[model samples]
Target: MFKMKEKWRYLKTEDKTAYANMAIDRAVLVANSECKVSPTVRFFTWNPPAISIGYFQSLEDEVNLEMCKNIGVDYVRRITGGGAVYHESELTYSIVIPESHPQVPKNIMESYGRICGAVIKGLKNLGINSNYIPVNDIIADGKKISGNAQTRKLKTVLQHGTILTDVDVNKMFLLLKVPDEKIKDKLIADVKQRVTSIKHILGDDINFNETAKAMKAGFEEEFNVDLVEGQLTSYEKELAKRFEIEFFGSKQWNHRR
Candidate 1:
């Protein structure tokens, strides 16, 4: 009875660097708003792992540059504002839709609820019982497994989140600063208690493709739409390339805030 747009591009991409990852999201948002592309559901992963901070968060306060460089973890600042996320062993999804779409919620908070519910449904598809923690997070059995960030620009809404397949608390604490060594140990312990991953819950090293498939079904069931397999156009690819070189990868942009 509540049928809306059924056609949505499903772009399941390969693992990429932090720069390229951020770029693709921006490309989709811009292209869709300009009517150059259709609404899309993108799933991707990070190669070499990466740390992405919110647009408003301070890079210095949130991440340790030396640790990142020493450990070879890519880092960038996202256009969407939220907390930092360590993109490692995770399935990341990005949803791009026109702000004026009849089915899409107009209010920001309501929009987050709508989108995050789809993510919750996705986890359910994996047989992982998780609850939406509101504002922008999903917790599985009292431990967080997914975190999302969103932004609206050029009349388009872009919401992206990470469904962690595995979490390296030792590695994460190294990248994110706490305080003293004692605090660092306590922080790691606290994080281990708070954050969780699919691998941990399933008790196996489940492939990301498997998780991606579950996500597809989850969003489909939750949103009542089909995810038509699609590819990126030349325009978005070109823009992503430019963004990689100029925006995401550039120190000026990464350290600006």
Candidate 2:
């Protein structure tokens, strides 16, 4: 029997506070697990900027909370395991799909390579050559341009990541705590050498929508599916609010190692 053609939801770009963004991703994952929504791809940007740490990372060890607050940057812990990331001047995307889906590899590393391939295609759309460097990074010209993280819950997989349009390594270092202040300068210099952004490569600033558009097309092509534009359902909205209050925005959740 021939398989049915696939169509995934494409949520266009929106700017949101850090808590709301994380809440929405989780809400969508839950909704998709219940089979209430189609496999979805959504893009968004951070408002007022923020720092998101991995699930297993210690908050105090990873982030300088006082500096974050003083500089009006939001901070939160993610449900996915990885290093901390400073969200700003970039496009963030989340994709929700079932683990049993044929296109999704059961092996975590292969799955990362497959999903990160979509991002590589997206960069190509913008006339940039990039490659996927496992376990979860995309690079351009030997410098990292994107970082991704994933989690499997309720038998569903949610992978989200950032595609940097511009980078400010200096500002990011200020908000992230260093194990020893002595190596701070060397670390920053090393990062600057190892990381890059769209603007740095293209010599132009690509706005959020344009970057998102490229990424959407990338997923469609990589998965061989149509991406239909959509919005959050009422149920998703309500769930996001609850998630924000109970988890993402809560002091207890963010502070919990």
Candidate 3:
């Protein structure tokens, strides 16, 4: 049996979604500096639906805020670099582990492969074939079903991703800025061609809660560890509150270049 050198924390957040996700990422980054947690895996969903832009992306250039507000979608910025993504209709997963953790890979692509392997295993459990595409996407038949990003610090690594259960192709187009003049038509066609969902593959509605549970089990098996449900440590809670105020809840950080 493989033994993990640190404790594993399993956290499920009900509908806190964007802020909670960002808060947990920050908490894990700080916690990694203080202790060796085998790794923390969080399963979460969004409420009041939101759009998250990548770290280096220009909010004005990448997102149409007026449309977002009109549709009651909250706009937030991610700490990782990637394109903007609409967050509804997806199950999100975030993992936090120390950089020195045995399961944590050294190179970025290798790390993505390692983390996405768990996702592959999870999808296979549902009889859906999936594979990891380099640089961080989980694909089925060349169409992306999930997208992931990672951030590394001195002692910690935070990797997070979204698994599509369903997506609104039209709404997604309305929320983001596309360069082409015929973007409305192009975006709709492109998304239909390039993105897919569990519902589309399984020929039925996916039960997200079951999927989340399967994902947690997949990680536990992959890492060879017992997953114990836990809450944020007092320190993590404090940091989360602070992070919500300083970074996640701030317009400055969201708009920062």
The models' CA-based lDDT, in order, is: 0.90, 0.94, 0.83
CA-RMSD of model 3? 1.8
Over 84-156, each residue of candidate 1 has an lDDT whose tens digit, in order, gives 8888889999999999987689999888888998888888988899998878988998999999988999889
Output the number of the TM-score-best candidate.
Answer: 2
TM-score of each: 0.96, 0.98, 0.94
Between prediction 1 and prediction 2, which has the larger lDDT? Answer: 2
Regions more than 4 Å wrong, model 2? 1-4
Error of 2 at 198 (Å): 0.5
> What digit string (tens of lDDT, one per residue) describes model 2 on residues 123-221?
999999999998999999999999999999999999999999999999999999998899999999999999999999999999988898898889988
Q: lDDT at 140 for candidate 1?
A: 96
Q: Report the lDDT of model 2 for residue 241.
A: 100
Q: Which candidate leads in lDDT?
A: 2
lDDT of 3 by residue, 183-216 (tens): 5796689788999988888878876688888888
For model 2, name the residue pairs that clash.
none
- Considering TM-score, which of the candidate structures 1 and 3 is the better prediction for this target? 1
- Candidate 1 stretches with Cα past 4 Å from truth are 1-5, 179-182
